[model samples]
Target chain A: MFDMEPEVLERFTWYMREQSALTIMFHTKVAEQMGLSATDEKCLDLAMRADGPLTAGRIAELSGLSTGAVTGVIDRLERAGFVRRVRDPHDRRKVLVEVTAGDLAKFAHLFEKAQQSLVQVLSRFDPDEIEVIERYLQLQIETFRKAVINT
Target chain B: MFDMEPEVLERFTWYMREQSALTIMFHTKVAEQMGLSATDEKCLDLAMRADGPLTAGRIAELSGLSTGAVTGVIDRLERAGFVRRVRDPHDRRKVLVEVTAGDLAKFAHLFEKAQQSLVQVLSRFDPDEIEVIERYLQLQIETFRKAVINT
Candidate 1:
């Protein structure tokens, strides 16, 4: 039953593959421009978006990175003066990560510019089309989240 | 003009960002499983999808990677036993990249399984909805492609 419409399935697969590649290319380019690895950039993004400094474990969870991986990413960001690691005053065993103000000022323009570029590209589609894509993506992410939990 | 529903715009941006991260996670997982770097895995994918062995320049162009970057990717793949660098017989100046049989066999199963996983996730949406999402993605890619070209 699942074997229906081989050609359509193939096209869908190719489309997904190409879209994925294009995304990687854009990310790599932006990361290079910022002198950061893609992972490090993502960690900084997660930190900046948080309401306040977040614990390492929370950052790892938010970024969908492992704790050990987040540690390395934080280390790199710290070395680059983009982030700082602070010991949680109340809980000595916990450490909080925060993006540096200097880094925020440096990256803010570029980040906004990137979003503007993306918006311009997406402007080709009508509002309804954009809404459909956004909803579809949300559904896709939820499905993956469920898969991860079940596994 | 840019302030058209700020909340909706923010949601759209987050959707793109999350989709981008999801793609990187998917590629990174597959590459790690294959004992290859993400870039090398991408080169192998391009070679497999191409009709014949591709020149470094062509691979770089098709992959949206710089020629020098593609060279480095091919070099790593060559070292990892997944791909071989072949000099064009007729045009000695051109180096053609080809995937190894062992690598192809390994990638074939992984690729199919990944596609099945994606299809499973996408299947929740009706066919019309899937088509709408696909069309939006195609338009997005085309817009980005033109941006790259114009820039």
Candidate 2:
């Protein structure tokens, strides 16, 4: 642990807050570009990130949507060809949501543009400096997930 | 332009996507805890981040809501005491949306926790390394705003 000054902490705090606001704006743009409501895009993002296919119940739980509302989200996503409902072989009664469209790849140009922007920023630093930034990002994400997301 | 291999770009891409998803989830949690609908919370976020108070028309344009729909959103947010409508002094016909709630301070614990998490992460690096991380953050936010958010 290191003793950092209050001003230093404040500056970092502003960075975090600003990054967070930009992230929300970026995702809003992403959802609009995808022609999905923010809620639907968020659900699709949830399903896409899961290690395995997620059941509707699970998505509802994760997204804080009602079971009934999740049904509607699945319906819209299905109609848009973004996802498919499949029965779980292990549990025949459960309907799992799977992202059937490489719909994400369709947006690769946008993501790649974002990646390029990141590349441009990273290019300014030397390898050793990049290492420090990478370490900070990795730790920030890990700690945020544990403290905020999972909590 | 520095050459970044596919693997490095890919890793950073994952970080961006993960951070985006987590930000949405955190906002959802904030909304749920605040008893505001996601749309209202998003609009509130927009107002809170604006350079000054926003007109209903600007909110509509930014939020992708129709004028009528924006009226409803403002009604709900106002009733909930999260925001208020003020007539612009220079343009009396224009109504501006203002966030009136000290309500965010009520959520200070959450922001404080996030700040503390950041403090813990920064403690791992020396001051010089911290400066590098700060520079990267400043550049990342600037580049992202210009390249992604504005576009």
Candidate 3:
């Protein structure tokens, strides 16, 4: 690590705080647009990000919700068509929460706008600069993940 | 604007999604550590980010909650000592939601850990590279704000 001025660190801290706040606000907007509660949208997002549909208990564990609460969350999400409950074929007794892409299409425009914003931001940088920014993001996420776990 | 390959754009899109998801998870942990619900934490976050205290109506508008719902939110936050409702000095009838920093200090260590992670990430880059990263962050946030509003 190289030496840096205190002022620079302070400014970077502000930037990080600003970004975090904006991220949550953007999510709130997404939840509102989809007519879902923040909790429900969070569960659906978890399902979408997972490699496969998550079991009810797995979502409960990851979301820090009780089994009963996860059941209610799944019910609400399924009723809204954001997610569906499917019997896990490998274990017929287990149920999985699957995101419904068809229903999610309704919110595509909102995401597409965000994508456009990203594309526009990237357009400003050259390949080398983009590579640098990408590395920064990758490292930041990985470090934060470890930090969150340790916390 | 510079042109980029489709695959490159796709990779960046995945990175963006990853970052956004991790942000929400980190927020969940923060709320849990602070003994606040996600909704209450969100409102407190809004109050913290604002230039000054926000009126109950403004919080409702920003949070997309009804006035009655906001009243409940304020009550919970105040009871938890995360925020307080203060009479607006200029307008006696108006009440403003103020984030109580003294109460928030209980969770300062969590934020400090996040800050340390950010510093560690930035330390990986030299000053010039750090400048590029900062510029990218600033531009991305500004563009996203415009896009979110236009949508």
Please name the candidate that would achieve the greatest TM-score relative to the true structure: 3
lDDT of candidate 2? Answer: 0.85
- Relative to the true structure, how large is the alpha-carbon lDDT of every model? 0.74, 0.85, 0.87
Candidate 2 residue-wise lDDT, B1-151, digit = tens: 4666677767777888888887878777777778888778888888987888999999998877899989999999999888999999999999999998586777667566677788899899999999998898999999998886457
In candidate 3, the residue pairs with backbone N, CA or C atoms under 3 Å apart (3 or more residues apart, or in different chains) clash, namely none
Residues A1-151 of candidate 3 have per-residue lDDT tens digits of 8778898888888887777777888888888888988788888888998998899999998888899999999999999888888999889989988888998887788799898889989999999999999899899989988988788
lDDT of 3 by residue, B21-127 (tens): 88888888888878887777888888888998999999998877899989999999999888888999899989998888897777788889888888888889999
List the candidate 1 regions with Cα displacement exceeding 4 Å: A1-4, A49-76, A109-114, A117-130, A146-151, B1-4, B49-52, B57-81, B100-102, B148-151
Error of 3 at B30 (Å): 1.1
Question: Looking at model 3 chain B, which ten-residue stretch has the lowest summed lDDT?
Answer: B142-151
Rank the models by TM-score, top first.
3, 2, 1
Interface C-alpha root-mean-square deviation, candidates in order: 3.9, 1.3, 1.0
Off by over 4 Å in 2: A101-103
Whole-model alpha-carbon lDDT for candidate 1: 0.74
Q: Worst lDDT window (10 residues) for model 1 chain B? A: B142-151
Best by DockQ: 3
